[model samples]
Target: MAEDMNVSKGKLQRDLGLLDAVGIGVGAVIGAGIFVVTGVAAGVAGPAFLIGLLIAGFAATCNGLSLPN
Candidate 1:
């Protein structure tokens, strides 16, 4: 799946230390969003795809490390 990405997949699963269960969650997330959302964003937003990815990635980064209550 990650291999199919046009960009390099930098061992995010390994770094995340998620066992099979949560890894599946992450894959499901990326797969769903990357599949459905990317085309829409690219079409409507066009040249902002890269910039949008940067912003979305930053948001995702913050979300990832956030502590649970």
Candidate 2:
């Protein structure tokens, strides 16, 4: 005798819109770049660290977009 097991398997909803997804990606790249590049940027560019951060972020975004997946 098999008792009824109400196992619900539903598709997870996609709640994030395009802008929200893009913003999250950009924020993640910038956030990670801060820690990873701060020392290098400070050593190389001194007061131009902010520009380094921007370039790093842009490069990260481009890299992310170019993936085959």
For TM-score, the strongest prediction is: 1
Query: Clashes in model 2: which pairs?
Result: none
- Native-to-model Cα distance after best TM-score fit, residue 40 in candidate 1, in Å: 2.3
Q: By summed lDDT, which 10 consecutive residues of candidate 2 come out lowest? A: 1-10
Give the runs in model 2 whose Cα sits over 4 Å from its true position: 1-14, 41-69
Q: In model 1, which runs have C-alpha deviations exceeding 4 angstroms?
A: 1-34
What is the Å distance of residue 37 in model 1 from its true position?
2.7
Which RMSD values do the candidates have, in order? Answer: 13.3, 12.1
Taking the tens digit of each residue's C-alpha lDDT, what string does model 1 give over 1-69? 766654466654434454867989989999999778878878898888889799889999999999999
Candidate with top lDDT is: 1
Q: lDDT, candidate 2, residue 10?
A: 54
